[model samples]
Target: MRDAGESPLLVAADTFRAAAIEQLETWASRLDIPIVSGRPDGDPAAVVFDAINAANARGNSTVIADTAGRLHTKGHLMDELGKIVRVTGRAREGAPDEVLLVLDGTAGQNAIQQARQFTKDANVTGLVITKLDGTAKGGAVFAIVHELGLPVKYLGVGEKADDLVPMDARAFVDALLPRAA
Candidate 1:
């Protein structure tokens, strides 16, 4: 977002997995970005609420909240995601303008299943396919988009923060199926 001239404040709302906060904090520090985090094992929704309030007070243009990475098959985790969404709405009306679901490019058919469940549960607005730097072609992107009718807003080409680039349909197609020399 900083690259796009928007002041972004990150919220570490993934309080479940160990080291999740530290990971986000590391990126925030490396990028010299502002962040809002809660105590360990604290309420993720509360953290998001606080982040939204902080963004408002600080005049930040965007608040990107990172929630726990939950498996779509897990009913309880899915419920928690719904709670976070509701809390986010309460924090600021018409908020969470975009809900993106990140998927492993190598996840093939399983990615479709996961996308189905995630979109059904979270109203996922777009997708981000990661691990494409490897042998993973991310062909499932086509199926997922066709099935859900959601655009893929970004592609994670590498591990670095700047590795996430905007999706260019032509470029992606060329990379996936290169033309003869």
Candidate 2:
């Protein structure tokens, strides 16, 4: 976003994990970006609502909310995600233009199943495959796109903020293919 000249506010809405907010704050401080966060144990939806308002008040054109991660099988957690989506829409018409689900590159077929549930519950529009720099080859990327029909929006290759690179289908495919001996 810094490269694109977009002012984005990072909202730490992952109230379930105290470390999550601290992690986000650390990143925000490092990137010199503004952040809006509520109590550690507060409702995630309320945090999102306030974040949207903060963005408008602070002239931030974009709001990136880091919500709590949940297992697909957790019905209540899934419902919370749905509530966050609705709250976002209510705060701003046509809000949450894109909901991206971040999946672990090493998760294999499980990631695809998670994507299905997340798409259904949170209306996920794209995927962000993380831990791609690990031993896992991220083969599930193909399965996810092919099965779920959702585009891979980004890839987290490393721990650095800049390690999150934008997805390129051609480049990804080329990298996946074995080199001629």
TM-score of each: 0.96, 0.96
Which whole-number lDDT from 0 to 100 does residue 23 have in model 1?
94
Each model's lDDT: 0.91, 0.90
Q: Write the per-residue lDDT of candidate 1 for residues 1-181, one digit (tens) a residue.
A: 7768999999999998999999999999999999998778999889999999999999999999899898889999998888888888898899778899999999899999999998888889999999989999999899999989989999999999889989999999999999999
Q: Tens-digit lDDT track for model 2 on 1-181?
A: 8679899999999999859999999999999999998788999999999999888888999999999989999999999999999999988899989899999988998987899999999999999989988776688878778887999999898999889999987877767785787
In model 1, where do residues sit more than 4 Å from their true spots?
none
What is every candidate's alpha-carbon RMSD to the true fold? 1.1, 1.1
Error of 2 at 6 (Å): 1.1
Candidate 1 has its poorest 10 consecutive residues by lDDT at 79-88
Model 2: ten consecutive residues of lowest lDDT: 170-179
Off by over 4 Å in 2: none
